[model samples]
Target: MQGAQRNSLRLLQWMMAASLALPIALFVFTSTISYTSTKDIADREIERTLDVAHEHALKVFETIDRSLAELNEVVRGLPDEIIRSREPALHRRLKRLTDALPQLKSAWIFDANGKSLVNSLASPPQDLSFADRDYFYAHVDQNIGTFVGAALTPRPPYQGARFFGMSRRRETDDGSFIGVIQASVLPEYFESFYARIGSDPGSFFAMGRTDGVVLTHFPRLDRDFRLDPTGPVGQQIAAHPEHGLITIAWPSDGIERRVGYRRVAEYPIYVSAGLETSAIRARWLATMGQHLVFGIPATALLFLLLALAFRRTQHLHAEATARREAEEALKHSQRLEALGQLTGGVAHDFNNLLTVIRASVDLLNRPQLSEERRQRYINAIADAVARAAKLTSQLLAFARRQTLKPEVFDVGERMQSLHDMLATLLGPAIEIGIRLPAQPCLVKADAGQFETALINMATNARDAMQGKGRITFAVQAAATIPDTLVHVSGSHDLAGGDGLVSVAVSDTGIGIPAARLGRIFEPFFTTKQVGQGTGLGLSQVFGFARQSGGEVTVESEVGQGSTFSLYLPRVPTDLLPQRQAPNTAPAVAGSGMSVLLVEDNIELANFAADGLTELGYSITLVDNATDALAELTMDAERFDVVFSDVVMPGMTGLDLAQAIRDRGIRVPIVLTTGYSQALSQDGAAGFDLVQKPYSIEELSRVLHRAARLRPVRDGAAE
Candidate 1:
């Protein structure tokens, strides 16, 4: 009987080993197969992603082409004489064309002579004399009905920005070649399209021209990665343009990822999609785990029954662990992706507000102003200008555009300066209250930006209450977010040990609706009526807080008004000196300097010339830079100053200045334009700039300043 028991035990051991070995081998084999399958699935998904990107890109291109075609058709219908002679009618048509297509940065028609007849933008070049331009020679043929030009940096009349061009030939009724109607699409429009491509956090999409010039990339990678296409991954893509997938170690994240790519058949563009290998592995593991979850118990039961026949529990545990890890990774990727989108939207809107404010302030410094009214105007202008500057600093902070400029300052004192202004801004209906710490609570921040952000928030609160509710500006230091925030009532939590400084603005107005509350910080998305708001207020607050290594939170109910809290990182530091106010405007007395004023706007030009003449300066007016240059060449020292519109026909103001300088004509040049920022970053160096919509006194002041600063030789000649 003992020998029988021993034999049975040996048999059981053998059965268990056999069952375990077979299933263990099978699990390994199955997991390997699953990994392979997941890789294949990922490749297919990436291919689909590329196809969608291409389709969307083509749609964008087609829409632009259609708009260009319609514009060309309109120009083609007009009589040759009307098209050539009627500048007003042509301007109206061009304006309509551009207004209908905001994505088009600028549109213009070049006559057979290469002269720009009409332009959507201010002051286009008048002469087609420059033979080097693509449109100049291309339009001379007039046989090309429609053609997409190479990616080229646009010149004046086309906004002098980087743009992709679409051009079509315009002809007379007799089929005679007339000119070319060209449209330059802005880069922002393309960037917007790229933004929509890859929604997944682990996924990145890039589109590059056949020449390997990257047109756009989603979730913009580092600039170095964008610039050097000759890197390992770029080399791989260059070697294989057809549909393919390859595993590569991504330098940015230090992770191995599978990149899939496809080149559009007829277009010189390639679309590439990148997916993290770990993500794919995780997905496969989760799927395999789900199967193992159901298969495990059944397999165990089978082992129990088979143990009489075989015996073992194998395979399940290892598979389950891998699957769980994969599921966790996917969840993490999704969370990060959602967060990125939220931050990106906030940044984009904040930038737009900065753009508007910067442009608006630059327009305020025009030369013409009477001494009597200058101080009052200058004071009001300075207030507006300061607000604009603060807006940009906040954006830079939010975008992490610059290093933090932290300083210790009393929030109470800062709020005091703006108390009266806020009251006036909110109007008589809204009651304002300020709550401050008894002892000055020192906090760190770029003082100017911090103050601006506070003012912006208070202004928004007042607006929300519709000028009828009570608004409170409160500040304190806290170790923790107070639970009883509602009843805090101007309390300060001192000795909280270096915590954040909390600035809260609360209003007793109608609360934000739940749906729109999430998007209040998006640029150009205002709840206010058109023209009343640019929809950047909350966005600035949000960006400023984040940029300062701080956070902003909002809470609101349907009926109760909303409260916005900004928690700025605090530190002990000395406060910076306050900004001193500039004195009232200097006297505007024009020196009897002869000025050559070149402008294309006939009425505006005449008005400006009249205004300048009234200011005691002799003015020589020309419709375009060509005639101005002609008159200047006729007499080098003919004028003390050359004032030209930056955007004009034949030669742009910048080009005209260059030409004059080339001839060693050092007449002090002043370039003026409504769209000054779009011209050039440095502007016309060595020359002064005066933005448009200038009053007579402002013009005289510019002339006076220019005359005063003239070179010794030029001043002696004048």
Candidate 2:
């Protein structure tokens, strides 16, 4: 099932990836095609505009050519003197023709000797010499049919606008060149027509001679200019003399454009129309933007749907995984339940023995008993009870049900204080060594439990060496547990918070077998001869380490030695100073010190009330926290201290204590329980706590401490 789910997840991921990639690929392909198409349209439009300019230029040139031919015919055989005499009639005819053609500025007739004979501008025109003019010299020599000249301003007194000359050679019947009949073509004529046609912005129309001499241009220049004969446009004109298209920058302005050129038929002039490349691209972008405006959202919506499908597939995969884990957990729990039942039965039998011993001890307290025998019985009973309590405490710790009172303390300081005690326990035969780090290593946990775990490991080490080997306790700050150590039982995730503090207890003794390490943490599992070891020591260490958010690890080599290391979450040393546990001595209940005792167990409550009453505490007994809270509510000052059990049905002691305080009652609260997960996890909520099966002296001390914390009133202690 897992393999199939994984395959399905992979398939969904691929589908989602393809869903996004395919649309982007298609959008890019379409955009590319659109760009090429738009450019083609732009190219064709430029060609068409060029053709229009060509036709307009052709008709104007043809009319000018025809007029020039007519003038040449009229003067075909006439001498200069005869033509000069008929100047008035000729001038009137030329004026009429010039007036009819808006493009014509003026017409002139020049003698071969470079003298102006008769001209259209004025009848009996000014006798300006044509010797220096280029048009007269061209006709005077070889016949260059319809010679077009470079752009020139008319001489002063005859100036209207810039124009270029178009001329035809005049000759007698012998076909020898006599003079020239020339027409002045106005540049503004084409520029005005170009404006009326409404061409795109930055586009231009131009007319030029074949030799790269610019004749006229729309959007005319401030000064006269010529095209480079070697440039792209000029080269195209030479290569494709009739017509062609080219994309090139205008030499005059360097603005790149798509230009189309046409050579005017039977004339030396060429006309071109151009559209700027920037403008063409603008058109293409506008089209592509429209496509994106619609296409992008559609693609995004498709992606969103695919994302939803992928999320659903992931959820299904998680459900399958959870089902598998649940089945495995159920099986594991069944195994744990079997083990728990065995342990519970043993604990039950042990408790019955303790009860019988306790009743016997109570009966022996009769008044008629002899002093010597009674003292001996009293000492024996005390020893047996202490041993039983310690055994039960070990069992609870191994089960992780002990109600721990955790506090922050310096590990190095605590370890230092244990040196003398450890020396006394191990005897002079076993050498003891203590190692500490230079810096203080602080940890938050039950300081008493931590010491007990250390002492348990040390005692085991002592027994392994038969009471004649060295034992070393090393404390230091650690980043993580060493991987080389065997993780017997407990969490392996020991590195957390600020880091970890490791307390390693090493022994020079016969090491434990590798096969036995795994089962060492099990309750009641032992390696020594019968009755020599309880096997609950390492188990208690394991439970304490796990409950403290840490772990215990061991490293050993058979016949050599073993090292047991305890790892606990480190507290920042700079955090508020370690709280010092106050020195507690056996306390006697004060006279008139009223305590509200809340307990659900009837027999236990009665025993506690009687015990405390004998110690001079005015005890008020209640079965549950509700009644205790009600008693406090009715008379807030009735009890100097509210002593309650932490674990109870309906309302827990912790809740009742909070309730009494929440109601503005100043009674001090002291809690007791065999084991409360609530107290272990979040502590006693600032209330004093006492462990179950506590002695009257211990109970009195806790109650006295709590009562002292009550608010003083009337300038006296409450």
Candidate 3:
């Protein structure tokens, strides 16, 4: 009886093992099948989205091209007298053509002297000059029949609107150029076309011009969404004009999305469509859920049957315990990871607030606070604010929250600026050396962030050396590595081509240990004393480099020093000239006649009104557009300029300007905002824009200069 029981127990154990193993094996197979099927579906969907977006983009190009061609034909048919004449009949005929063509916002015939001859809209008296216009020169010099001008917000004829001009040279029967017939298409037409192209819910579609500025987008387009072709997405599109798609998992939302892009051949524009991966996985999840629903009951039934048939089942409990422990470990690691990310985000936002407060406080004592005792107290407060701001900036750097405004700048120039400060920081015990090329070796990065990173690294080096060491800063063009060459360091080989810049910072100190090197970039993982380091220096540098579309790598050994190399992508030659120092405020101006002030911030508005009044300009203050329009209708000529905030309660500043223009009120409109680039193109166009948090000097200058100007016809309109 005992022998029989032992054999039966062994058999029961084997049967129980198979039961658990079979379901797990089947689960793996099902998951693989589901993943493969889902990926296939996603690929097909992405391709379809790209195809639809491209088709819509092409249609826009064709519609504009055809409309311009028709306008050119009409101009060709007209006699030279009729074309050059500003007769009401001629204007009526052109107006009819413009009205008949829905896409054509306005049609005009301009003689060689750039005067509006038979404009579809109101004809301004002055003879316009086209010699300066890009489209005009392209038609005149290059003799390109169909010249499409850049996206322009039409100023005059149809003020406070956005349009792009399409021009064609009008030739006489003798084949000699007589004049240029131009048609303007409203951007709304393009925007509408994109909207009709159809988009998935929770998905976004965007079209970017050749310059990397977003032309249109489904839903709303944020100010920062504009084409910055040098950005990561822009660079990808530029480099790969063919079918390209990228999948990114948003860390903030925990949502994955796939962005698929295709270039439209007719124009230098790329149409992109995105689909949320979570949405795509919904069906798969549902199916899996159903499977699990059935699986649970089936699994329970199998367990009950085994317990009834077998006298003992000790092995099952041991296996279950092991699985639970493994799961627990994974959960623990994930919790830690999440906590770190949350800490970083909090640090970043706090830093930005500190920066604003510090800057504001510092500005308070600028006009000589050194004399008065109270002024000295205020200065002390400002100093404390500055220190707090610096601490926040460091936290933000560690958290990767600070905004990076990058531009192409010479590494040598940047290094030179920091040399003295770095030397002072290191003390007499350490030596600092910089080796940079005489010629500008430009890298695209935010100067402030880069400087901060360098200083942090230098500080780390100082600490490692125990306040004595030699630090070297060097920059050069990265060596071109052939595609076929094998790299032993596991680093991605730098692509061979022009326009690559590299920055290297090396320190002669007790180097990092091999074991600790990998952990160096982990926040709060410091080797220093509790009070000495927050353990975020290397991490900040890593984040800054990565955010700038660059890579940072370290080379170190136990005894030798450490070398950190930053590889930043090069700016194109054409873009290099456009690069300038980032300015906090607009250049200041001195005097003006009359001004309209629209600000919701009561204190800021009062301050501005006082400042403008002091600057010899009469100021009309209104809280919102309703009051401004009521005032404007009462006396349009009373105001020389319209100064308004962008984000107001009821009618936006743009809407108010549009309303004023609709009522035939023409004045130089200046729009100001704390978040300057956040305004849409339609809202920002036609008026001069000034970013806010402005000094009195900046506000005065903008108003004075803008007030001095009268409404002039845009060259592109002609």
Candidate 4:
């Protein structure tokens, strides 16, 4: 059962871990795939935007080149002097061309001496020197097909705005350069077109010369800017001169971007469009945030449910364990109850038979029967009765119904006496060792039962050793009983004080197996083979310890040995009673005294009445307490003492005694029983109690003592 519960808990823990980990793993995986796909989409969009910008740049430059071609054709065969003479007509034609195209700022023709002979800005061209201009110098050497220059502010009329020029070199039939025809293109033309095309935030658009000169940019630069010759975009363009895409930081502001570039066809220029890398990241983050908004709660709820299930399983496991323990306790209680009933009944019946035999034996022990054979028969019968009494005592002890006479005694002194007795009983092959405390260890328990328990433990140990090992008895002051034993005993209420005295019996024997340790205290449970053991030794010890308000603990290892320790509630040394030496004098006979004898069994009643008659007691026999009560009520002064058996049919001896006291009867009552539950629970109840199967001599002394305890009556006054 415990194994299954643990497995269930382990499975839940694994599921909890998986529930959280799998979702996060999937979310991260899906987010990664989405990011890559989104970036690919962004790259394609950049390429498309760059394609539109590239087309625009190509058309504008081609138009500017065509105007230059037309201007060159007008002066194809004209001499330098004729071109100067036809300047007014050429200026009118250039003005018409500039008006037709919104992208073109103006058109110009430069003479070989670097004089601007014709211009579109003014009817008579300004005195701008073509000798210092880049276009004029380039045409002087060789005819480079359509040369696109760096952005610059044009002279006068086109000033305050930046422009780049497209120029063509004019040559004679000999292919020698003579002059230049140039057209100025406005940077605002591409910037306005880029705005119209509609780009995202943080997007860039630019056109630049292949020589790394930036011509025009949307969201224009504060000052003229150029791409570095050795930078990322510059290297990208050099590697793929026609068209390609690259992600790089803009040299102007260091903002990372995904850029697409294309080289305009047959022109020394490139166009690019880009969107910032931060914008792509923003798109990805927004998508992932949406996933988290839904995913996090689902994971949390799964964890919460798993946590609840784990707690619920633990609760159920606890309840199951509690229920199992309860059932076990109930079964044990029932077993003890049944044993008590059986033992009490058997002991009660057996004691009556022993009483009859004892009475017969006492009759034979008279001095007149001086024959050796008759004396031997009486001695043998007496021995048998004593042995039978011991047997019944063991049964009553195991049933936990034995009468206990508790007295505060020193444990160390008691063990010292047992050390010698056990040594002889266990034989020469066994050794007995004794360990005593320096100070007296005092306990309140039945001294006879205590010795019996120790003897039982020692005998078991002797058998375990096969009568060939060492047995040790020790006494000590303990703070409390061991927690393990406390739980095993389940007698927490017995451990009352901080002071506990431990009397431990240890043996170096073969030891008990672990599998059998827990059942060793159960009645009829023994490791010995049949007929060799009664199996009630340890159970008797267990019941005796519990009935004495203490607990017994056993510790054993298979090959090492076993220790049986009794933990009894300690008493103060001051509570110990003064020891009295045993009196060796013969039993005193009774004078003519009256005894009201209450017995349910007629044979046993006759036997007791005859025995007491021989002891010089005047007996009034009654079979039940009711008859005795009626006799006492009729003549309260007849008997001096009531010697009633404790167990009878209608009313018990204890109840009769109470009735006598309640009726104000002045007689002393003496109760006797073999085994009575009432006697066990309520004790002697201020009445003197003698166990059954008593010797006639002992019965004489008890009747005499009870008669002595009676109150003297004022018969003269009555």
Q: Of 1 and 2, which scores higher on lDDT?
A: 2
Best by lDDT: 2
Greater-TM-score candidate between 3 and 4: 4
RMSD of 1: 49.0
Please give the TM-score that candidate 4 achieves against the real structure: 0.52
Better of 2 and 3 by TM-score: 2
Q: How many clashing pairs does model 2 include?
A: 0
Please name the candidate that would achieve the greatest TM-score relative to the true structure.
2
lDDT of 2 at 95: 89
lDDT of 3 by residue, 1-718 (tens): 3355466677887777777778878977997798679767776877886787788667756766676677676667677676556457767777887787676787777776555676788644345565555555566644676666666665544475566676778676767666677777666665675566545555657666667655556654433235556766667777787768877652224356777888788566678876777766775777778888988688778966886667434454445557768888987896688568547644654565566566657666577544575565566655655555555555555555554455677777888888899988889989888998867777767788888888888888888888987888888776543344222223553432455677778888788887776667766667888558666677778767666656677777777988877667765445455545855665444445668889988998999888777766778899999999998888877677889988898898878877877888878888876433234223366677775455677776667677767765345254
Model 3: lDDT equals 0.69
lDDT of 1 by residue, 1-718 (tens): 3355456557766766656666667778998998899888888888888788667666666776777777776776775567667766667777777787766777777776656777776543365442355644666665755555544665554345466566777777777776777877665565566566666546766666655556555555444224247877667767876666788876555678887777765555667777788888888889889878866776676667766542222233345556767987987886576456546644654566556556545545656755655565556555555554454444444444533345667676777778888887788988888998776666666676676678778888877887788999888876666563432112333332467778889899788887876667644457788457655567667666665656677778778998888776556534535756954575464557788999999999999888777767788888988899899889957688888898876678889998988988778888877553335334356677775556677777777778778777734634
User: How do all models score by TM-score?
Assistant: 0.34, 0.56, 0.40, 0.52
**By TM-score, how accurate is candidate 2?**
0.56
Worst 10-residue stretch by lDDT in candidate 4? 483-492
Clashing pairs in 2: none
lDDT of 3 at 612: 71
lDDT tens digits, residue span 435-514, model 2: 99999998989888898898899988999999998999999899988777788884455546799999999999999998
